[model samples]
Target: MLSVSVWPCAQADSKAQRKGRYLPEYMAHPGKMLPAIAEHAITHYTQPGDLVVDPMAGIGTTLVEAVHADRMALGVEYEPRWADLARRNVEHATDRGAPGYAVVVQGDARDIVRLVGSDTVGKAALVLTSPPYEDSLHRHVRCGHGSSLTHRNPDESFIRFREILEGCYLLLKPGGHLAMTSRPKQCGGKFCDLPSRAWQSAIDAGFELLGRYVALLSEVRDDDLVNAADVPAHLPRHEEVHILTKPANSEVVAQRVTRIAA
Candidate 1:
């Protein structure tokens, strides 16, 4: 088991960066749970020196956590402020007693394959990301002056979302693991349908469903927060974390064989 203690921070390296905590774009943020998530993946699917990638790298919480745990982390953020903030947080984390490698880029995750180099991105052993929802959840109120809602059409959300996932797919080494945090249940006046779409997207993007659980924050109560403003009475304010993996080893091998034969 590779614990966070193995990678103690080294203050000697001068390459520093961060994204300050000036913006609060999304309230349903997964800021602190990242360390546990990264630690979980490291214990189960990776080693002490593997790589972790987060496409939406919101506040850089995930990257900081990965670096503290002694794993290299790569992040892509469409928002410059967020990306810069993430870089700063990562740098400060390593500057502390946490040891590991971290890198953040400001760009669309759809271009990850090109930005990080095709072969390099496709060779990671684990990818952990908290992607944006399909709907324009934050259009009503823009916090921190963050630029999230791309002017794309309805399906464009899913298209780019899947593109980001598939980009991770190509970067994930065989047998590698992928864990994504998503809110699959949205408040739809009379009907709710967040999980089905999420499931469909995951399957279509070449990820094998592994496991999922409610992300119950031990310190905070989300039920009260999400249900604010007299929202749906029946809606349960809970987020489901989908644990998925790169297609199994055998499947990847068979595909390679078929391609070679062709």
Candidate 2:
């Protein structure tokens, strides 16, 4: 487990340079993940030659980091443009001398089986991603601060989130791990407790809580507003990364024991 502030070299790409060109009006603003954060998570949770997956691969940060760390990476992206970018990024970061590879499939993550193939089911060593925060898909907003902004219908958004989590659970091998980054959202001038919602969803999908770590952002603009005297403080400058694991079945456990005995 990394310390709250130990993730080094965390930096955001400028919006002007994110996609290298003007995007279509319908394309949502890119919420690029920090390469350093992905690298740290990959290194901590996976081993060399292990398979790592990112269902909501945004520009391939997780894939690139995984390849750089000598882990085979598989990612699924909804948009073709972003999927292409992810492949380029992964190729640029790949070490030719290493045995690992990266594959990015352009399709909906909710249908991960079709995207990655049925053979990959129950074989991933780690599932890592920072999914789109609730709401603010078509707009840019800080984590947990946007309430009035709307993208997908509320019911649709929740269903998508739940489905994504369930998909992640289904793809993991028994005893494989899941790490996600999210924050409590603010709605109606109060905290919406999204972390708990995500936790419950993961539990419903049969994942056991392993740990939770709070990673603080360097930018305090959002926190400063929460501390303002006029408004009650409801949000924070940090995001929570929830770690979970799929329990190993008895057959899998017996196989492991026999291997150790041999």
Candidate 3:
């Protein structure tokens, strides 16, 4: 295993921007995650020895946990520097007998099938991710993060995020699962719903929702200042965890057609 590097980039500022967009690579610390991502994935989706992937591996938190839990881990990052640091961190974080892991070449998720080829690339098991929010503190979509798969105008993330989902849908083996976290834009109005656009994106990608959980920022971290701001914002706020699964062929058809045909 490669050793971790105590590099300056690994300790970069969270608010750093690239080309006017918030760089997610900068935001990838152990503290930036939603609570349910790790717990739900550990409980419901994966089994030991299975492969677990996080397309937006960030600081390698999910993959780190997956390795500790005995799942082979794979992560993809849009930023080359982050990809390097993540691999380094995961290697150092893993203990003896933890499942093996690898960080692949810096590539676009749009061609995920091409990068990893098959969903079962490393004994395919499950996927867990937290998509980037489209808007910012002022409530308008914040675009410009170079590492996001896509950065559509009038939208937050780039097109690569969509490709990641598409690739994930195609990559999971039959019975594999996916989990993600997201919040709606109308979030602070007391009437805004959990963003269903991501829900629709999952549905379109062919994963079925299993269950959901919500957690407050206080439950995960101390965000008193974020909430105290004059403008309502997502930083240091509550978030929803969405679980999805691709039903096994048996669940979908109730029987194996191949056996009947034979």
Candidate 4:
């Protein structure tokens, strides 16, 4: 396994690059996964022609990155709006000559096993996704007009999240990896440590923890880190990427595969 602790993947041109790859309307998505983060996980955890899935795919960032890296991609999105956009994004990637194929299913991620079908069970090489943050994070403001945000019960949301994680466990190959990115945020003026909660959820879902890495959302300048999350003041400078695997003697199998490939 790759042992890097921090991933300095936020490039200067990240915004422009993302705008160019995705549809204009996708910019409104509340929690879109960074392309760099998706790319890094796909490159390290999967191989060409391998299957990569994103259970809570928002705008298909993982799917787009995976297909561009020559890996088949599958995504399950809860919102029909985002699912349509995700499907269009995959089509856009295909039109741009991405070699690998991709499909986006519109459904709840907790039903991922059924949504993806029995044929796909235990076939995915990697499951990369980022769970949604609190309701406050999803608020959209435009020209001094803010969209109405629905308050979510944290406990209920966490329970659904754990169910989704369990579904992801069933979708992976015996030695497949699950990579998730999340960060802490303020909920009702109180700090909510979602990453820690997600880590526990993965473990409860029968996955063996492998690594915990940081993917920086900021840039280094003049020997100092430039904090990009300035608006909320409490937003984290980096998101935690937790890597876990299905507990099917996966460690030994992964090491053996590494040796064979080497």
Best by TM-score: 4
How far is 59's C-alpha from truth in model 3 (Å)?
2.1
**Better model by TM-score: candidate 2 vs candidate 4:** 4
Evaluation by lDDT, superior candidate among 3 and 4 = 4
RMSD, one per candidate, in order = 8.6, 7.9, 10.1, 6.4
**Stretches > 4 Å off in candidate 3:** 1-31, 34-36, 95-100, 119-123, 134-147, 154-160, 186-194, 220-236, 250-262
**How many angstroms is residue 197 displaced in model 1 relative to the true structure, after the best TM-score fit?**
2.1
* Residue-level error in angstroms, candidate 1, position 81: 0.7
Error of 3 at 114 (Å): 1.7
lDDT of 2 by residue, 27-128 (tens): 343465545566677888889999999988867777877886789999988767778877876666553443468999988787786679878877899998
Sorted on TM-score, best first, the list reads 4, 2, 1, 3
Report model 3's TM-score to 2 decimal places: 0.66
Candidate 4 lDDT tens digits, 146-240: 22111345566777787788777767899799998887766656777878888788877777789999987777788787865432445556778
- Per-candidate Cα lDDT values, in order, are 0.59, 0.65, 0.54, 0.77
Off by over 4 Å in 2: 1-29, 95-99, 134-139, 142-150, 187-191, 219-236, 251-262
lDDT (tens digit, per residue) of candidate 3 on 87-137 = 765666553444556554456555655666564432457888766543332
Query: Candidate 2, residue 151: CA error in Å?
Result: 3.9
User: Which residue pairs does candidate 2 place in steric collision?
Assistant: none
Candidate 4, residue 225: the lDDT equals 74
Q: Which residue ranges in model 4 land beyond 4 Å of their true spot?
A: 1-4, 135-151, 221-223, 228-234, 250-262
- For model 1, how does the per-residue alpha-carbon lDDT over 19-120 read when each residue is reduced to its tens digit? 222223323332323344445555566677888888778767667767778888888888787777778777677778678898898898877877677657
